[model samples]
Target: MVHYADPSMKYKLSRLNLARTDYLFSRDAAEYATYILNTSPIKANEGRKAHLQLLTKCAAALRDILVFGQACTVHRNIKN
Candidate 1:
């Protein structure tokens, strides 16, 4: 079961029927890939791979924020 330190976010997520934030991050990753493919000089598979990696890092960065970070904590003593 998922435990949330912020009840409001949990409630909002439940209302939206989202079990996890992966969907949002995946969508961002795809859009980032498209953006990189279209505008960046990198081009092709290399560009796509690069952008995917960047977005992965962006999503990982969210794990440090209190709101989003809470979702990833596995230990009771862990604090963002």
Candidate 2:
């Protein structure tokens, strides 16, 4: 039972019986972030096309963030 600072946004998260898996962010936050980044829109019952599109978008975004984030960190460290 995790105590949440915001009562209105309280959620009871449970452990899933899956190997090598962990939760990073909330579902709502993830969806919102995806939308804000203008990634592929996953529609209900959209089939394989939607799935592929989502994967492609996710891969591109992940690469961009990792590359830029690492670059920024290196630059900051060099300056100090």
Each model's TM-score, in the order given? 0.28, 0.19
lDDT of 2 by residue, 1-80 (tens): 66778765443232342221434446667789878656665465344344556667533344444443443344356666
**What lDDT, from 0 to 1, does candidate 1 have?**
0.67
lDDT of 1 by residue, 1-80 (tens): 88889989888888676645666688898999898768877534553454645667533355554653444646675575
**Which segments of candidate 1 are over 4 A away from where they belong?**
1-19, 43-80
For every model in order, what is the number of clashing pairs?
0, 0
In terms of TM-score, how similar is model 2 to the real structure? Answer: 0.19
- Candidate no. 1 TM-score: 0.28
Could you tell me which 10 consecutive residues in candidate 2 have the lowest summed lDDT? 11-20
Q: Which lDDT values do the candidates have, in the order given?
A: 0.67, 0.51
